[model samples]
Target: MMRWRSRSVSFFALVILVGGCTAAHSGEPSSEQPAAADVVKVSTPDTSPRPNDPGLDAKLAPVVSSAVALAEIPAAVVFVVTPSGSWAEAYGTRAFAGTDPVTVDDRFRVGSVTKTMVATVVLQLVEQGKLSLSDKVSKFYPEFPDGEEITIEQLLDMRSGLFSYTEDVSFNETLDDNPGYVWKPAELLAIATSHSPYFEPGNGFRYSNTNTVLVASIAQQVTGETLGDLLQERIFEPLGLHETSFPADGDHTMPVPSPRGYLYGTNVSALQTVQLPDAQLQAARTGALFPHDVTELDPSWIWAAGGVISTAADLATYARALVDGHLLTHEIDRLRIESLGQLDETNPATIRYGLGWMSFGPMIGHDGAIPGFQTFMGREPASGTTIVVFCTMRDSPTGVRPANEIAKNVFRALHEN
Candidate 1:
């Protein structure tokens, strides 16, 4: 289902591949393994803050730290990068149920940020002449209804008006009944397609995870490789990312020396505070009992939408690579073309969506949230600076706005410095 007309109130809140093509390493066997020494305690400010470094530390550190502390979020990670260099800082305990400290390298779900990578991979195929933007969805999947009417460009641009399954109440009911269930790609789609189109294709804009899932499936079919494999071949290997992966199974554990993630609730709507509706709580509570505290959401549920995980360094590199023409220049152009369709009619100063990303003036990127994670990656293209923030806690009501805002301040501070 693809629905792209949702309002800012709907979005209101709220990356890289590794080389070698190996299956992702499984979560650590024991919970008791000693935490790595390099995992910074996150209390102290970065010692050698770079000269042009946006002094993001000086600008938003207090604000972000206060939010994380006030909300009782288990862990938070901030990363800042420019043409000159990059640095990562960590804060809070790794485990909410215990005393372990959070680490920088830990893997949390990147959520919709995964769309950027998925879009990149698709654009790569387009560049190689394997696919074309004008191609219709029916070209790849004949069974898809109204495929001929829905062009690949529309899908990439979020102009496809299919109903998002995420809005399905029945699907939410089933998810509530089985919080630990691992969803397959087809299964997830079936839920969304069960509903009719939200609006005529190409008439409006909505943020639909299903559009990304479909893209991933199509890419796999055309390339005859898993999305993970393609990412390694096209993006990760060239970039030299040592710690990124698409876990085939539902494991969410980052290796030792990484921050642990904590999921606050079950529903996609309002923040799932510590209140009841608590049966879904046990599987989540596993993060407390196990040392890795890994999660079990089937990667297929997110597919291209929110699947992969990586470190702050890798994310910054990927963002820089995207802007530097390392990825497809034309597709990047397509991404930058502002979608007046999704703009807030009430506030002209507010943003409209872009292909797999968003634009705030000259600053362009996207922010994402899953149960236990919130992340943002943005770049001021003309200035040649990129900012990224990742955290383990998804705040109630507030979402990841703090990390996103901190990233903005970080960039401004660095620019001013």
Candidate 2:
């Protein structure tokens, strides 16, 4: 919890939704759709969009630069938002080799962050009466094991009890064998259905990718369009998330002017090894700092649950609009927020889960990790601020906390001034 370029669905099918929201500030192209040959594109703002500081860029740049070496990240980008305006800045190199530095427009895979958009669409459907939280999965596909007992609400809340397909060894094996395989949503779901339910439907809460895939498939079923089409029609277009996209099976490219994504703490995948002569293996001996270029691999295996490719800019604006409930009514939005379930029993500070996101105190955001990208996005509604951070590596010795550190620094720089 803590959340497509395919199918030509019109974003303006619905009425124009306008707000005082500001577009992202970047000197580079922020489109999720990549251009040929990884060209660098930049666009610096003529006049600073107000974020409560004029020298904010100067202070924030150092934080990102330091985060790269301090946090041992490949590269990092941070986008900060306030009620007045927003801006994004990036530091470090785009790739692991050479001097190809990262720009503000560099797009990266946003892991579980994809969940929030999927949830918004689901709730939209619920509001339209096309679906209901209480509706049983059996209503859509009774053939799915335990379909009769599972509710759509349970699916959105990560209580569906469906086994995450990514956890299946065979799926990982296939992933390693053919990194470019195009996976259909149903095909991915089959891997989970092959196994029995983790528990009974709604019996327990365990974050599972299978639940989201089902939600996406159901959305496709209800809308008579692909999940990518639905997202385009509902969220991306309305929110003006030009730099956001849902890559389907055949798309194996990153956002134009992107960098090579790397992964650490892994032994099974096809990543390059950066082993030291006398290396002190970090955490689980999976191999420290294993560098893999998974940037070109087809990412359909994690569809719906974690398939969205987005830039720091799009996420910044999208986060505020999403948290502000610009697309849905207050009744449904409040219901979604009220559905939070505790994740940490003893020390649940902000570690809570709702319809499609997890909370970290007053900040509502989610972090995600695929093979080579670790992403975190949060919005503090009270201050009308949204913060997003992305790193090219999935994990470091620092875990996924580097992004959070960068965000906190930005928050303090903007608010504690």
lDDT of 2 by residue, 1-417 (tens): 100112111221111111000111111322343222221122222222234344656666666566666777668877776656566767778877559888767888998899998988888888777899999876876455666778999999889888888877778777767889887666666667666667777678889998888887777666555667667767887676777899855888886778788765343532333332235445224433456677776877787888899888788777777776666778998887677643332221447788988776667768787777878888776766678888887766545456766665666666545
What TM-scores do the predictions have? 0.75, 0.79
How does model 2 score by TM-score?
0.79
Total residue pair clashes for candidate 2 = 16
| Full-model lDDT for every candidate | 0.60, 0.69
| Cα TM-score of candidate 1 | 0.75
Worst 10 residues of 1 by lDDT: 12-21
Put down candidate 1 lDDT per residue, 1-417, tens digits, no spaces: 443223221121110012111112222232322223211111211222344234544555665566555444567777766555555677877666668766565655677777877887787667667788788977765546677678776777788876676677766665556655666566566666666776878898877877887777677666556666666656666676557777664553445466555554455433234342344434434443222232454455566688778777677777766655556655545554444234332221255576666765455667777656778776666767667777775442234444565565555555453
Task: Identify the candidate with maximal TM-score.
Answer: 2
- Give the Cα error of residue 153 in candidate 1, in Å: 1.1
